[model samples]
Target chain A: MRRRPGIGGLQKAAAARDQYRLLGENVAKLRTDMMKEQLATFRSQLEEFARKHKNDIRKNPAFRAQFHEMCAKIGVDPLASNKGFWAELLGIGDFYYELGVQIIEVCMLTRSHNGGLISLQELCNHLRQRRKKDREAVTEDDCLRAISKLKVLGSGFEVITIGKKKLVRSVPTELNKDHNQILELAQGQGFVTVEEVQRRLSWTSGRVTDALETLLEEGLAMIDNGHKDGKCRYWFPCVSSVYSSIGSDP
Target chain B: MASGSSIGVGVLFENAEVTTSGRPVLRRNEVECFLLSSVEFDSEDDPPRFTTLKSGNLILTTHRLIWIPSQSNGAVPSSISLAAVTHIYSHKKSIKSMFHSPRIRFQADPGAIVVTIVFRGKGDIDGFLTKFWECWRGRAWEEEEKSESETSRSGSGTVAQGLYGNDGTVRMVGLAGILRKEQEQWESTDKSLQDAFQDLNALMSKAKEMVSLAEKMRQKLLSAPSSQNGSTDDEEMGSKEEMQQWMLSVGIISPVTKESAGALYHQELSRQLADFVRIPLEQAGGMISLTDMYYHFNRARGTELISPDDLWQACTLWEKFDVPVMLRKFDSGVMVIQNKSHSDEEVMSRIRMLVTKTETLRAGVTASDAALTLKIAPAMAKEHLLTAETKGLLCRDMSPDGLRFYFNLFPEIDPTSQHIAKDFGTYGVWVKATSMLSV
Candidate 1:
């Protein structure tokens, strides 16, 4: 109602404020309801879409990854449950599950010589060989998803980044900052001498010695003193190309 | 990691549930106060009956003394309920007792049996006995039962059904349940809202309920399958995820408050955070930036929001506990929470495969390219690439296009015969890959 601009106006303002609060709350609630409705519809549509392109999604790794990305955005995890609608319809859960098992098999097989650290390419190569008879080709996307799921099994399986490459660590050994730095320095020649590490990393001799000794102890580093410079070369087999043949099947 | 339940049968002791990580699965509202590893639980009344449960980890909680085996054996993971304790004998100093492992003796019933706990591990025995005495005298179980009964009495009119609360309110389930509950809540909320505005004091008192109401509404939004309704449009999907994230960070039904946990606040909070992060961690691909974790954790806590310091303290406390998740600091000082068992070999292997591809081997891959290939964030992909480079899996090539990572061929270059390439080695493979690109 129209009112005078005085003490009565103050009362009117208070009433208006209360009304505004209520209106605001209602709007928020309605928005949430709308969002939920939209989500439900999207889920139904996704199921339909998956049904239409099951083969394309399964066979084409790029298409499968794009589909997975779409699922992630909508908060629909086709791999969340092995017995859910998506799993039954797409069998994507079992696909990832089987991939997870094979991943472990590969890690366990290569752990002996690589000292639990293997490159992604080597692991995928082994995996592809193992799954060669299978119809669908597995991609790095599938491996990442499968490995992410493996976190539930404890801290035994994980992916770590060093420099520009990703290393898959199968053991629970922690590579400290210093260890990582030393490893990075060795990337140039597949080996780093103690003096070379000191020159590049600018680390104190004690610190370098401690890190190198720990790496050697972990069996991650192989000592190669057969050099003309007389500098003890620490050859990291996990990082060095010389040992790429380690996990390769004869 | 212990993967499954190994609850064993015991004649004298109560078999308790252990988590996949081999820690005891605490009951509702129960908080662990202290832990002493490699402690043996033996009955003085019958030595042979309790001999099986030897050198296990003794955990003292508000309501029970859980003794989980240090290593899984035929012996069952067991506990002696503090509720059963009849009396605790005070520590005695003697020449003979000083030579042996520190032990605490307590008397308990069904048969008024004397239980002796031998502490063989390196732990503060005196401190453990103090907690044991405190837990026994606290009568926490009785207090819990009393409060539970009071809640039930208040909600006497409730008809018990699926997802029943102690107050007899039907906890909503599914879309229909949510819609029905929404109507009931709105009506009650409207009445309360009007009443709260009547006086300033009333508003202050009603603040907690207001917070809880917000929590309830957030949960409803969270429960609803809103993501399913979004079309194949990317912008809509983005907003849907954003909305879902907003909803997710709004409520934790029973946040571990400082008032509730008191001196054991951080410890309890640590355990709760450990349990809470499993879902979010899985969603984040087993690792989450600490800052993101902080927001998610605080949002889920609703009204009982914690400080950054409190979260930091809780995360740091994880190192002492056997929780499956651990806090890690990157070389750049960015902290992250990840699974304790997250092995780098798994990721490294994948990255290795990525760079060695025919085209990638020649042109090399940028962080964005790696991110696209790996299905991870570009920043995370960069971290992985850096780690791989550090490990000698790849070498960086700084070009106009930016930092591109190529498969390291230095090992295959034999310095004496640098011009020559071996057919069997990756050097030869790289030459073939690059040569094909040139042709």
Candidate 2:
């Protein structure tokens, strides 16, 4: 109560500060303890729920999805360990783990053709082909989930989107905007001439040449000097070629 | 067992089981704190006669110090419990200590043995020592033991045997007994369900028990098919598996919610994202777009979904942490999470191999062709093809047949003598492959 600036007053102020610090520490510790307790209870209850509804969660996709949502909200990773209750009861761990392996096999087998890049739809098609005998349909969502788990191997595995299409990149090669632009433009005919790119992109000839030269150098583009117009065609192999109007009248 | 002399690798310290990947198996609730590579563990005694461990990774956890050899040619994974550590001798600052490799000495129990850790590789010796001291003083093992003992004590009291008959009721016999038991069980389940649905609060509390009933019903359905006939129907089995398959994905049970993590929300979220992205990244073949990640992450999170900005902020913050996954923005402004170890050189070499093939050389591989061969998306294949093109490993050929990529014969063909057939080069190979196709 003494509002004096003497030595005794300073000592009292220091003592009060120390008490406040102690109280704050105690409150923080209490809060952490409470949170830990809540987490423990949540975990136990979630385990019980999963155990009870294992069959339903496994059979009903929508219900299973809801349960997964619940698990996520509570921060429980059912797929964290294969030897756990989740694995024994649901076998969910092995399912995704096996999917991951299948994905790797698919990527490895197709690496020679796509240069380590494949469209999600194409990947799914290959996956379906491989899993023809398998009754359970592997959705793109499931693939994404399984692929997400493979990040532990490294960052070389990733999914990138180009012009509304999701493409899975197995390698670490980067594609610039200019390169992506040219590829997008080439998506229609699977080829773009330097003049066409210059007109469409409204870029200078230098920019177009640099982009086309890069694509050509990267083995992504092939030059067709044999064209009737005499205009050199930079063909992008990554874009699906539209050969419907060409010579197919066998 | 790989080598005769190295049989004593884990003789002195307790034998620690390692994973197939050579990572030391951790005790329940035990967490790794610090890791130092290229460390040697041996006795500090003169001649180091008893035990000698060389060229191993030293991992300091909350409970033990694990030593895993780089290559398992001979050495075994070994661990010393933190409880066994009696004293950690401070580094003696002298001219002698400065010249040699950084080392740490700590006296452990059992034989009161003095263990000397020689750091042959570059690492923070002081930091390791500090963590060592902290782990030792923390006594985390004792807490685990205490909790384990308490659980065992509580569990030992209950010894309920069998179903129904143990209560000393008039046990119905054979089929009648089974029917009665089923009836009672159903009644109990019905009551529990009714109680759960009484109100939202009641449902929340009984949620755990309520969900299990569905499983019981499914199990019954499964057993019904088996009981009805000796042979199982293919359609039923397929449907059952498919139903379960819907819920087969991994769920982050304990997502880092704002309520739980507070001010460390982004940091915790970043760490969790790093862990979460591993599977998807692997599936996507080591890279995934930010948009895809957001969808997957949110889908998993269910209700407590974060905003795009939040996800972006969390990814940007990954640079400050020692996470394995990183936020990579390409020149096209497309953001992706990639492993730090992903190498473009490997992809380039694969592309080089692809284009140089006789079939590909003749026809000129398109993005789809590359996608099929490379086992990647056409978009990604295009990126690689573009990259290969930029490296001058391949050339473009565009026509009515669309775009195609061929091995860059530009470098091998002499500009002055373009028509000359050099029998050895890629040009010659291409000519040979294409001529055969034309004929």
Candidate 3:
């Protein structure tokens, strides 16, 4: 209120602020560098741990889960790519590649009967049966990762849900909403009657008939008219365990 | 099954019902009208002999008035059918009432006993009374009986007309009348279909009618094969069968909606979701992804779509309620709904069986392969495989082709003697399989 500060005073204050900002930035940069170095060291230690406990990691799921937890904390994704430090150290990438080829072969072999729409479980069963004498074990997780990699093929390989079951479609057949709806409804009994669908979905008979015809044409569904109820049962083979066993046997 | 002394006052009422979750069972087409918490049932007329029932939820459904004890320990829940209720006395307004909680009195039968509903917790007293009157006067029970008979008559009448229309002796209606009737039916059906596709709002309104029409057509188709057996060819039969299949898929009669359920939306939605997921869960081998569930549930609900946040909230509330299913989060942060009784051991053992095969030992199996083998979703299959890996049952193999899993041979392999194969364990078998491939 007495005498306002001059331009010289204002300039001096600005210089002090600038100096403080520079100093703060330098300190932050140094801290970041230190953290990066620490992270590098931790990553190498993790690699050593993996090498040391390779046997335990392979033989024990609980131990592997813990090891995975440790990897997560360090922001290390060992499964990100097949060709990295992990691939060289663990030889996992080559293993998945080999499995992918076998999966293609199996899919090709069963394409005729299933019309390229085979349940994942059935495929696994066939794979196991094909190599029953081998001592090495395979799990569904390994199969899934392999399939994800197969997406690059552009060959229309995909996993689709019909009800709760997953079906591996090797073809490029498109399924509309009507088809999906029918598949979902059939999940309860593995089959559905026209009356049941009509009552439940509240669709016109023509629409219901049209959807069912498409499904039948696609060979996704089978017809059963032998019941005493006199109602035709449209059975989705993808969701029916009994149908899988019966259809796959021959 | 606790002591009788802990039980509430016994009221003589007929046909009381309870659900598997210990909640009052609602009749088909019956909707809950009102709910009041901490309601006490007592008769001031018979004080000493009758013990006062306290701290229970009083629910008024379209068909009956039910009171369920808040705690299940030793309380005997009771219900009085609206049909049995003789009269409802007006709430008395006196100087003494100004200091007391809100109360309503009603006279029910079997015996002309006056039952007083004392609301110890806050609720809409007027709304409950109004609904009580409307339900009593409406006489919905009688309508149910009439509708049942009407359905049977219509069903048989249609069958008779459609199947025996060509019989020469039974020409009650002229051909012109039959043709005119058919044209009128077609026009009506066409109008409905056109209206349904006009706009979303129109479709929502016409959805119920569409469902009924679909049901009628299916009924006609069901009897078509039996009546026209001689004229039906293989191609015609095939087309007819296809038509039948389509009609079978359209269902989900009453979907739970927020507007309909109000404050209890999540709880009601959770219950309905539980019932809906049973078949799908079983088919999926006991577990399904939350994303998949969202799609199925919304599709079943039709127009009344729910947000993901609401679904998550409903799933979280399952922990508070005694439900047969549970929500699980994988290490990958992928959420899923699974049966409470679903066991991982069986799946683990199945994986164990799968990996030990000769080809899998040498080449490994991918997640899709495992999904196929386990009869589960690829995502769920991967979770199981990862769990197996963590348990040392399997080890992962990552390659350019894909990620695959093989039975753990690391434990049996002598890491120090890398080039040599131990002649006994899984490692040896794997080595043999690979060598044969090389040959």
Question: Which candidate gets the maximum TM-score versus the true structure?
Answer: 3
Give the per-residue lDDT digits (tens) of candidate 3, residues B93-186: 8999778888898887757778888888777777778767877776667766886897788656644332113234333585456445544544
Using TM-score as the measure, what is the rank order of every candidate, best first? 3, 1, 2
Candidate ranking under DockQ, highest first, comes to 2, 1, 3
Model 3 spans > 4 angstroms off: A1-250, B1-11, B14-24, B45-53, B93-99, B148-262, B283-285, B295-305, B330-334, B356-369, B375-379, B391-439
Output the better candidate (1/3) by lDDT: 1
Residue A70 of model 2, lDDT score:
47
Tens-place lDDT digits, model 3, residues A129-197 = 533333444545556665765554333466766666776755332312345556667766888888888
Candidate 3 chain B lDDT trough over 10 residues, lowest sum: B160-169
Q: Tell me the TM-score of each prediction against the true structure.
A: 0.43, 0.41, 0.48
Candidate 2: where are CA atoms >4 Å away?
A1-250, B1-63, B66-78, B82-108, B112-282, B285-287, B290-329, B336-375, B397-404, B414-419, B432-439
Q: Which of the two, 2 or 3, has more TM-score?
A: 3
RMSD of each: 22.5, 22.8, 32.0
* DockQ, candidate no. 2: 0.04
Quote model 1's TM-score: 0.43
lDDT by residue (A1-250, candidate 1, tens digit) is 5767998889989998898677656745565555455445544443444444454334322223334334434443322212346744554544555466456546655644555567788888877764444445666776777677555433535687656667676544332335655655675577888788778767545446655775676445778888897878887644544223222312
